[model samples]
Target: MSGLLALLDDVAAIAKVAAASVDDVAGMAAKAGTKAAGVVIDDAAVTPKYVHGFEGKRELPIIWKITKGSLFNKLVVLLPAAMLMNAFAPWLITPLLMLGGAYLSFEGAEKIFHRLFPHADHEVEEDMDVGDPVHLEEARVRGAIKTDFILSAEIMTITLAAIPEGAFWMEAVTLALVAVAITAAVYGSVALIVKMDDIGLFMAATARTGFGRSLGTGLVKGMPKLMVFLSTVGTAAMLWVGGSIIIHGLDVLGWPVLYDTIHRWAEAVAHGVSEGLAGLAAWATSALSYGIFGLAFGMILIPLVTRVIGPVWSVLTGGSKPAAH
Candidate 1:
């Protein structure tokens, strides 16, 4: 009887430890996911476009394919890479993160530039002109997966950076949980957004009540505006997060001038505000300052990227030249 009681007590203790570990994983994953919010928003916003113009029946299937590709990108490719980096080359994390941040900044700024300049998208036109639906779908899926790879790398890196150092297994589990949870959240939201029009149309046509019909009609009409809103918000988030990351990276790497200046400016603004709103004012000021810096940095990168890097990449990859921006 004593032996049995001891065994039971040992098992109970193990169970308690396991439960605590699970909670820790959940908490860490949530925080890491929050840190990667800009990339997550952009991923969700960008994915629906790959399904655009597809037959409604095919839309879900296409999204499923892309979602699978995204999972593979994050879980199979990025997760292992991140783990290896953490294990061996931990010092490289900040530099790599800054590179990713610069990429995000460039992407956001390029979007704004395109919007302002209103240039034609030759690549999009080429895709639209493709003869076979099957081939076009394949090409679009490949492009989207390629894009997702870059974004997923950013997400995983940001998540890894956010995780507090602990046991190796704890870090591994936290990263894995973050990868799965973030991929599911992004793709799940994409699925819903892509299908929303159909859902709204079905409701509008089939709903029994007048209010239901009106609501459905509203959804159908509102989706386009919603997409535009999401795009704008995603761009802003990218600039804010990217600039902040760069500044933070610089601070980590022993150059605190920019970071200190931004902090001082934010503090000055915060002190000028009423006590009740001081924190909000400071945060807003910091975010805006970061975003402005990101936009300028990104604009500088655009000419170099489009004029120099794009051509070099094309030559090396043996691909056609990128469209002129």
Candidate 2:
């Protein structure tokens, strides 16, 4: 009887520890996901554009394919690579993060640069004239997946950096959860965004009530504006997030001047507000500074990337570079 009781108690203790570990994984995953929000938003915002010219029926299938590709990128490729980094060269994380941040800044700045000096994309014109829908779809999917791999690398790294030190298995589980959760959130939102017009058209044509038809019309009209809003927001977010990541990485690497300056400024702004709003004030101030820094850094990168890096990349790949994201 005593031996049985002891065995049961040991099993119960093990169960309790397992439950606590699960809770920890969930909490860490949520925090890590929050840190990667900018990338997540950009991913969702960018994906809809890939599906733009495809027929309505094919939209979901393409999204599904991309979603699968995204998951593969995150789980099979990025996850293991991140784990290896964590295991062997943990110090590399900060530099890698800064590199990713710089990429984001460059991307955001390039968008602004293009807006200022818009160039005709002959390649885009040629792409549209592809005779077979299937071939076009394949090319778009491959392009989007390649883009997703870059973004996913950033997201996974951000998540890995955000997670507190824990057992290897714990880190692995947390990262895996982050991967699955983020992939679902991004692609699911893309799916909805792309299909919304079709849904609106259906309702506009066949809704049983006048109000329903009006609602559908409004949705159809509103979607274009929504896409514009999403794009603008996504750009701003990328700049802010990228800039902040670089700033944070610098701080980690012992260059505290920029980080401290931003912190002091944020605090000074926060001090004027009520206690409850102070955090919000501080955050906004920091975000604003980061965004400005991102914009400046990105602008500097634009000419170099287009003039130098693009040619080098084209040479290395033996193909012309795709348009900048």
Candidate 3:
């Protein structure tokens, strides 16, 4: 009887430990997810444009396809690569992250350039030419997945860095959790944002009550403005996050002038504010500084990318125009 009791106690203790590990993984994952919020926001903001102009029936399916691709990107591709980096070339992480940050800055800046100059989008024009809906959907999904891969790389690296030192299994578990949760959150939000117009129309037509109909109408009208707002926010986020990464990377690489300068300026600004508002002021100042740097860097890369890289990429790809970021 005592032997059985001892065995049962051992089993119970093992279960307790397992439960505690689960909690730890969850907690760490949440913290890491927050650390990657900038990329997450950009991911969410950027995804909806892929579904734009698609029929209502196809929106969710396209989102589902992209979500699956994003999961594959994170789990099969980036997660393993990140683990390898952690194991063998942890030092490479910051430089690679800065490269990704530069890419983000370039993309965000390109959008602004297009807005200002109003160039024709060849990719969109090609999509319009594809008569088959299936083909068009496939193309868009592929493009979105490609975009997701880069953003996912940023997110995974950031998350990996955020996790506290632990067992290999624990780090793996934390990263996996971050991957699944962030993918679900990003694509889930995209799905809703894309389909919101349809939902609003349905509600406006089906609702019997006058107030319900008005609310539904409001939703339908509001969606366009909301999309614009999300796009603007996403661009700002990309610039801010990208710039912040470069600054942090510079500091890590022993070039701390820009980072320290920004810090000092932020501190000075904070000191001038009321205690309750000081933190907010400091953060805003830092973000603004980062954003300024990001924009400048992005502007410098734009001409080189379009004039040199784009043409080279086109030739290598057998004359296919490069996809717009």
Per-residue lDDT of model 3, residues 95-208, tens digit only: 988998898888888878888999887766776564678888888899889878888888999899889888999999899999999999999999888878878898899999
Compared with the true structure, model 1 gives a TM-score of: 0.96
Model 2 has a clash total of 0
Task: Please say which candidate is ahead in TM-score: 2 or 3.
Answer: 2
| lDDT for each residue of candidate 1 in 1-325, tens digit (9 for 90 to 100) | 9999999999999999999999998999999999999888988888888877778899889888988998899889998899999999999999999999999899889999999998886776776574688988998888888889888899999999999998889888998898888889988999999889988999999999999999899999999999999899899989999999999999999999999999999999999989999999999999999999888889999999988998898998797654321
| Worst 10 contiguous positions by lDDT, candidate 2 | 121-130
List the candidates' TM-scores in order: 0.96, 0.97, 0.94
Question: What lDDT score belongs to each candidate, Candidate 1 first?
Answer: 0.89, 0.92, 0.88
Candidate ranking under lDDT, highest first, comes to 2, 1, 3
- The local distance difference test score of model 1 is 0.89
Per-residue lDDT for 143-167 in model 2, tens only? 8898899999999999999999989
List CA RMSD, all candidates.
1.7, 1.3, 1.8
lDDT of 2 at 309: 90
